[model samples]
Target: MRCSTPVPAESDKLKLDWTQWIWPGPKRVFSAIEMARAGQQPWPKSIDYYVYSNVFVLLAINSNVLARGLMHWAALLGLGLSWLALWVAKTLWREPTRRRLNLSSLATAAVMIGAALLLKFHPFGLGPDLERDDRKALTLIIVAVVTLAMISWFFLVLIRSQQIAGRLRELDEQALHLKLARRLASAQIQPHFLFNTLASVQHWVDTQDPRAASTLRSFTSYLRATLPMFERESLNLTEELQIVRSYLEVMQARLGTRLQWQIEVGAGVDESLWLLPPGLLLTLVENAVGHGIEPSLRGGSIMVMVTARPAEGQVLIEVRDDGAGLAAGAQDGVGLTNSRERLQLLYGERAHLTLTPLSPGCLARLQIQTLEPTA
Candidate 1:
């Protein structure tokens, strides 16, 4: 069966209103705040929540020395400064260079100095009545508040930097995987392979051979399955096996009786439940045909097997050929290298691909640990 790609309807496309373009920043900020409040972590218990709460408590405790209006103004100013500090930390996190870090430090120092000046001058026209001892105490309070703000800003920047680094690493891995997928697709559909297959089809057609129609059908099916396979991140074993079967059939048609192949599934194996990186199995089969069988004087049989181990939570796949064994000092080609890297990216250390040389042939085995279906 062929896998069909889904296309979204016209109504499914994103349609933005005028507010989305005009007030995008505020809308996104509010939306994010709402999401944070509704998330698994309690918003009230966050570090920022505690920090701001402490600042307000300090302002309220000293309300006797300062006017009520002045206290409110100071509270608002502190909140605004905290927001600015957070914005600056996020900006620095995106591009954490030495120069940016130095500049942010200077900016933070300037903000603290400005806050002290505002408090001393009573800019809100509601000055605090204080004696010599009271002034000293107020000065100490300002120092403590500044120190707290500075420490909070430092920790905020540190946390943001770590988060940004992890996000960037994930993006880099995804980009590398996509690059390898495209390269493997190109390698599989090389001009020489296509030209050779077409040449065989043309000969059969010219000689009015009966195999011409079936050969063309298999070639069409192979193209239909392969063209869209790499566009996706993964495929179920059933869809991948269809591609493999079509490929083997086309090759068999070209080689005539010299090429023989069979696919075997263990009794408990459900092909649809097993998901794999696209074109992974196809690469192994191609290796078997090109390196293991085609190069030999008498082309031999290729066996593809899929077995599931429910108790062990693993799936084993093997592609074996009773043809020429591995040549001495032969390094892995682009296909095998790309396959290994793709497997590593997908399954980490839980999946392994090994090529063992038998007495008369070569065996390529792949074992993947998977308990549930991962699509």
Candidate 2:
């Protein structure tokens, strides 16, 4: 099964619109929190809370209640408590651990109890005519608001954690599948390749042809370069090119004057500094020879080019064969499919392999985001 392409990294950036303000759903709220955690700017939800609290204060001032001053103070206190709740939620989102959760809960309860006691005792002496029932209702309202906010945040954090775990599992499965595909590709290619080369060598030796020794040497070099590739996950571009060159040389010996090839490195491209999945380029080369060159009456030339755009952090590798173009209703073989899967697993949407039909042939292009080589 083909893996779905991952979302682009830029899609994670917060770009709020009118719809998000009208109804900030869980996704938008979580994105706001993430932006705040990343130390970007204040999230819109925080601004909305402050605005709503001030609006409540205004409504309380305009009311014809007996304890207008008490209502004002209650509004202010609610604002402070809500802000504290938001901070607690942010902290929990950043580090959702049992220890932190317990600490935050204890702290919130302590603050709420202290506030309730202060309101009951009239410590501030701002609302002398406030009644017992009014105080009770006000206290209940504040506690309910704060408690609901906390509950919502806890559930949000829980859901986020579950999503993260699920994504990790998906990645693990993809990695396992990639490994199995690599082994399958190796098994499919090696025996048949060895048999064909050995047959050619045997025929040449029996005919006492002058090309036998050179062909044997090329075959030895190809085997030396190809065997260790399957054991590694990645290799430097220079090493990959070496393997491709060796394979092409062996092919040339077998199909003399029919297969011609060249490798070109563009300026500013340091082949040794760039890395690629093992056998990636060689797979393209093999496909070109098998499908494009060999089927034609007069085989054509193949060119491998490596170019880099450092400013854009992009690398492009093209394998072009001037032979018959893609056959009618042609589909990718196992080697091509495996190569694509490997690239997807390694680079996500940052890398892609595309085959474009040329005027007289086909161009297989691999574009990937460049990474600094590890020391």
Candidate 3:
């Protein structure tokens, strides 16, 4: 069953680049020159790998045909199969890295070798048996050479593909990190939040209450202790909640009767769930206080709820404020922007955030699954 919010699903699938599916022409050509640097491949192989791989290609095709039928139907099928087998070996052998032959290459050589031995051992033995065996032996050597070529080609492709893929992944990660850094840097002091907290503190401090000033100082200490958190990569859900609670305490001391608050921590949220990027949970609370509670003028109440389902292995955080609520695109504050980017960086497509009007108030929801150690 779905909860108050439906579980989010991946909207896209991981995909390999289309170009990887096709052969890399330039790479193979360059690799060919490097492969034959030994110059042992006397021009015939140098001209085209097909010269070496053709036999295996042919054998594979013929085998497939034979498996289907040995009758007249298999006749042209066998010949076509043979040609295909050779083609496969020729292409595979041209690359030097695999440094070995493909199935087609080995099978082709085997087929020819088996056929030659069979004829030599025929009960009658072919006429001039020595000369017949001599011809077959020479052909066998050529086929062996081609098989080796195909093996080389396969290895080359494997190595090159891995290198290209690794580079692409690096670039993507770097782009994301830079974006995160920019968002964090722009999130210094959101004046409205500061203005509201400070205004409330000044209102109480003017009354000459030492407890109120101490509370205000404690609140300032909390802000100072937390501003450095944004520079961090991650902090756990428990740690984040602790920070939020400290902030709520500051607001409660200042607003007092003007603001009512509820902080509920669900028992299921295990400390071991995972490390979340810093400032995520706090962002939800900050928005509630900044937009939801502060803007009410007459003031209102906010509920901070945290639920964890350890068995299901997920966590949910909700900040609900019973105030004037919000309009479309109402959650575009700098803190929210920082949070969205941090989530995207950490989970790619897995984590989700939602903001909506809860009839009489505004609700900010965060859901996360698989909070295993990033390391």
Candidate 4:
């Protein structure tokens, strides 16, 4: 008698087939499609098609029993039909007319329902005729409906998020353009500043004082230092302080003994690590001198104090002067208004400029949230 060959075990057969049949073909397809579309796919539009296609394929597959050859063929058919549905959905509903969109959606739903029914019932023996169980079938239909609804909701949320992000980007761009325009407008030295400084130089020159030449030199240096403010968005605290010192030098030449100043920097604060909005500090200082000191005949002292509170995550700068305090119901002038607007634009609500009465003087305080240290 001839020896018979041994047949492989059922478990071995299943193991071999698992890799071929149980793999995620639909997920792979979706990922590949996503890659192919990439940035070319429009938001909201592509999302609808993607969701519809996925839901349709899932419904088609879930409505029938899975078999060896039947499963493979069903998957292929599901993929092809889903792709076709996607193409149609993308092309048909493009018109913004509400009636056309409604019609296309209805047509798509009808086709999907008909195909699902045909596959499940096998009316003409196109596939295996699964036994109909009312309870089980009803449960499956409810699940499919819920799944489709959830998918639609998810895509809708995605569409809304993308729209919000686009709006925010456009606002940022507009703000940036406005910032540039404002910077250009502010680039010029106020005519009165030049006239006053020149008048001081003329007074010195008429008296034949040796400091007249030095005063002109200081004015030139101040102009050179301030020119970069128009070109830069921000400056290091130390650099800004240098600019302020240059400004103070020029002002001292004009004010003579009338302008006395002090600057105090805080401990544990790295000036290089911190940044200031361009021209912000200078504006505050100018406001202090113009509004506080110039009006007083006795000549006053101005104090600039910078402090960082690491525990509180804040940086505080105070420009104070021993001169006249704020007038009651005093309206904001152009300098103060422009400074406030710039602070709001750059820091939103996280930064502010406050003018408060301080005993014999007023304090112009600029408070900003500190940034986290970089890695």
Quote each prediction's TM-score. Answer: 0.62, 0.66, 0.56, 0.60
- As a TM-score, model 1 comes out at 0.62
Tell me the lDDT of model 1 at 48. 61
Which parts of model 1 are misplaced by more than 4 Å? 1-139, 142-187, 372-375
Which of the numbered candidates is closest to the native, going by highest TM-score?
2
By the TM-score metric, which is better: model 2 or model 3? 2
Q: Local error of candidate 3 at 315, Å?
A: 3.1
Off by over 4 Å in 2: 1-66, 126-138, 149-157, 177-191, 202-217, 227-234, 275-277, 292-301, 307-375
CA lDDT of each prediction against the hidden true structure: 0.72, 0.74, 0.62, 0.66
RMSD of each: 12.8, 11.8, 15.4, 19.0
Runs of candidate 3 exceeding 4 Å displacement:
1-213, 272-274, 309-313, 328-334, 344-350, 371-375
Candidate 3 vs 4: which has more TM-score: 4
Residues 1-375, candidate 1, lDDT per residue (tens digit)?
Answer: 999999987766865566533222112111233323332222233656766777688777776765455456556665666666556655544443344545666667776677667556653443345333344445556566656655554555455445445555666687886877655653466566678989999999999998889989998998898777657667889988998999899899988888999999998888998777778899888888888888988999999999988777899999999888888888788878878877876788989999998767789999999776544
**True-vs-predicted CA distance for residue 199, candidate 4, Å:** 2.0
Give the CA lDDT, 0 to 100, for residue 73 in model 3: 29
